[model samples]
Target: MNTLTDDIDAHALEAAWGELDRVARLRPIHDEDSYDHAVALMNRVLDVMGDNEQHPLAGLLELLATLVGNYEQKHYSLI
Candidate 1:
């Protein structure tokens, strides 16, 4: 069992899902501050994903990315 606070060793997002699941939903990334947190964590994950070309985590990352993007788009529109 891996806790999110534990050092993330696996670079693949899918491989990280079980660990991510442990913490992902616990942190609410809805508002600017929360989203910033999410972005920072996600960017770290992305750094680990560098130049892999293929990773099991890609799909899950894509899903999370889209979710975050949509949330930002909907909530932060100046219009």
Candidate 2:
């Protein structure tokens, strides 16, 4: 079983970096257009992963959701 303190090997770290780079290439949501794109990406991720907390893409989905939420909160008035 894996624990939080377990160190990730170099190969795993490299793979993680690769994934981050690929995702970063998708440009984060900064304006209306990017916001729409981000929403689409988030929807795709959700469709694949659903609400499974143990899914590999869960962290990425959560990060995208947070980015979308932050952009919306800043650009639109909340009720």
Candidate 3:
């Protein structure tokens, strides 16, 4: 099977990630549904992880926050 060390290339990497993405609870926010999902996930992560930077999921929390922030800035901006 094609793998990362096989010189598989970017297309292979994307294809592998796409399979996971299909079942992923969190992904890039493209619309309201995705936006809502990301927000809910972030909230849950916040509740469980809080502001603990050393927590294993802190990076995930940060990424989810960034996704939500970017979406809001694009869709809900007053400017």
Please report the candidate that would top lDDT against the real structure. 3
> Model 2: how far is 57 from its true place, Å?
0.3
Q: Higher-TM-score candidate among 1 and 2? A: 2
**lDDT (Cα, tens digit) per residue for candidate 2, span 1-79:** 7876576587888898889679654566777888998899889889989768799988878889999998888888667
Q: Which candidate tops TM-score?
A: 3
lDDT for each residue of candidate 1 in 1-79, tens digit (9 for 90 to 100): 7789576565675666667677665254668877776777667657778767477656656766776788788898888
Model 1 worst lDDT run, 10 consecutive residues: 20-29
Question: What is the lDDT of every predicted structure here?
Answer: 0.68, 0.83, 0.84
Candidate 1 clashes: the total is: 1
Candidate 3 segments whose C-alpha is farther than 4 A from its true place? 1-24
Worst 10 residues of 3 by lDDT: 19-28
Per-residue lDDT of 78 in model 3: 98
Give the per-residue lDDT digits (tens) of candidate 3, residues 1-79: 8776888577988987888578556678999999988988888888888768799888888899899999999999998
> What are the per-model numbers of colliding residue pairs?
1, 0, 0
Whose lDDT is higher: candidate 1's or candidate 3's?
3
- What lDDT would candidate 1 get against the real structure? 0.68
Evaluated at residue 15, the lDDT of candidate 3 is 88
Q: Pairing residues by index, what is the TM-score of model 1?
A: 0.55
